[model samples]
Target: MRAELLKPGVRPREVWAWAAFDFANSGYTTVVLTAVFNAYFVSVVAGDADWATFVWTCVIALSNAASLLAMPVIGAVADARAEKKKWLFAMTVLCIAATAGLAFAGPGTIVWASLMIVLSNLAYNVGETLNSAFLPEIAPESSLGKVSGWGWAFGYCGGLVTLGASLLVVTQGESFGLTFDQCVAGTMLITAFVFALASTPLFLWLKERSVPRVNAGSSTDSSGTITGAVAESFREVTRTLKALPRYRDFATLALCGFLYQCGVSVVITLSAVYASAVMGFETADTIFMVFLVNITAAIGAFLFGYVQDAIGHKRALAITLLVWLAMIVVACLAETRGMFWAAANLAGLAMGSSQSAGRAMVGVLAPKARLAEFYSFWNMALWVAAIVGPLSYGAVTWMTGNDHRMAIAVTGLFFAAALLALMPLNLDRGRRAAEAAD
Candidate 1:
């Protein structure tokens, strides 16, 4: 089946160009959202309010909610116009500008910090969706698993590289005659610069394979104007949502993705918080730890790409999901910092593999003609998960008197539910459904 789906014309450099966007954007999440800025927001920007953590989660949730609303519309519009690359670039620009805006936020600037986070994160999430939508258009079906894993591996390496740089600035900037404030701001500007520099190859090299759509989702002629196309896109999104169940495997897999992705989101967004608030790790310790974990994550993503194809996507994702469960248990049981560190590295392994597998599953399952629209739905699931997972953690910690152990334990439910759902997913049927649609 994959042999038949395989096509020529995918250049290795083009593939790398696509992957470099992942590399480009990793610094934003790693430095701003995950490591430096989040902790800074809670402790400094919010003046150490008891509600600071919850408020930070609120900002994240709000941004994801915005992404959830706008992603499908944006995808549909880009699909109709065959302007995905343009939209991607626009979002990237917005994110970079917003990230730079964050540099100016300081103590007693809660609203300023919140606003920047919302804008930057919203751009980041939408841009990520657009990037995922490119996979089916680029990689042949036979290479989907490998290429998807390859992209994730690149992404982790990007995280490591950017985080490594941030670590140096944080640790050595004082010696270089930079104040703490300047170092933090410098890191943000550096991330913005790296994102722009790394993504240049993508714009220059990765060709847009999708032609203009006749459907309202893509073509302005169908709707008669860009505004009309936008309106039609909203309608198409509605229709698509109602139509999902007809493709049982795709729908089921999306559901499973929604569930597990929630767990993944929590892990990514809150791990640093947990490290600091629970395990007593400082900024430097968390950065260094996450740096090491990114190494493990890259290895896991690269090695598991072959394993995914050798076994199957479903089985590969299952293995990763189970690992997530084990990771949670380890985190919960850890009485010492060293034990918690083990759990974090275990999480790194699961994080990259599961995400790669999930991505490949979508690439294989989405209809050839409506790749962007379908990916938008999947991306919506991820945004929704982003909101639900981390927000729930915040709520749990808030209600439980900041018991991070309990918060993390609750996150395991998402993965467990996804595992149960995976048992019934028919990947072959899903692939056939996609082909039939095409």
Candidate 2:
């Protein structure tokens, strides 16, 4: 491979432009999806009170289920047509509209909030599906880890910055700061606008390539017109899954990813609420802790990119998983804010490493022609794992009636299982290179 082609297909300007979308859009997941809005909706806005947890769980389950149902079909269609950017743009718009709708959600509007969240999550999943599909088209396989790491790094940067602003506005308690309601509404509106604006350049810079073995007429209707797109997408999904079994490593990696993501998503998703409600930390303190984690996560992503290129993906992933398990163990046993911060730091280091390395490993293992389809399967597993995490956490909390610490401890077991499953896979240097070339 030439050194020139190892770089992203778009110029540096375009790469930054593309990455900014991740930076901008991540505010929704970081602040609204995981941290700020969730706590507010459950604790403050949902008045039927005891039913709050159940409502959030149902929304997550339904949203992830919808994404899983849609992702493969969308992936196959995008792969078949090689039109990732168009799909990406469409999803971005849908997400923007959904997020904007959240601005209307206020006290006693639990139903509206849940509907908007589901729609927002669906759009987030679709946009991520298309964004990931474009990775192989832009960067050479040899440099994929680095390029993907850059995106993660920027994403964390965005999360931290926007979340910092949210902290300032929400925790100020009307001492020249906006009320909680204003903060929530402002966050929603600004997040939507920024995400939509940042993603525009992707549609301009990305170039499409043809997919091998895709039927030219398959995306259209039976009358030789371009109707029934949804039905066509579903049929293609069926075709893709039937052929997926032949990809052994891809299948194994995806299963491992699914199990491991249960731990990962729970940590990020519940960190703020756990800190504030369980540990007796103030909301401002929780936000600061979140900032610390995001900073460490950005650094971890870059460092692990090097590790993935050097020591190998499976080993790097195993190392991170061990750290993750250890962190959870320590976190569960701790009693003070100091101990909690220490655990958060440890988790932050391992968090980005696991995700970036896992995805890079998938990039190497998947068949080049079916990259989009395989990645969609991988993403679906991730969201499914995410859904399981919160539901399980809520269920365990309700049953044991113990501290949230038990939920953290239980998530550790999943990480350990993923680590054990991955230990037997010997992905040596020569093998990884060969896989990448394919």
Query: lDDT of each prediction vs. the true structure?
Result: 0.86, 0.74
lDDT of 1 by residue, 1-438 (tens): 233333467677878899999888988988888888888887788876778888988999999999988886688778888989999999999999999898898889889889999999999999988998888877777778888888888988888888989899989999999987777887788888888888889899998888986544444655366677667778878877787876888889889999998989888888888888888888888889989998999899988988999999999999999999999999999989899989989998998899899889988888888888888888888888999998999999899888889999999999999999999998888888888887
Instruction: Please provide, for model 2 over 1-438, each residue's C-alpha lDDT reduced to its tens digit, 9 standing for 90 to 100.
Output: 244634544566556666677786777787777667777776767852655655666687788888888776677667766667777888888888988898888898878888998888898988987787666666776777777777777878888877777777766647866677877777777778767766777676655654544464655424433345566666666765665455556667777888888888777667766776678776567677878788998899877887777776777888898889889988998788788888998888898788888777766766677678768878988988988877787677666663577777888888988877775564454245335546
Each model's TM-score? Answer: 0.96, 0.91
Clashes of 2: 0
| Whole-model alpha-carbon lDDT for candidate 1 | 0.86
Name the 10 consecutive residues with the lowest summed lDDT in model 2.
Answer: 220-229
Candidate 1: minimum summed lDDT over ten consecutive residues — where?
A: 1-10
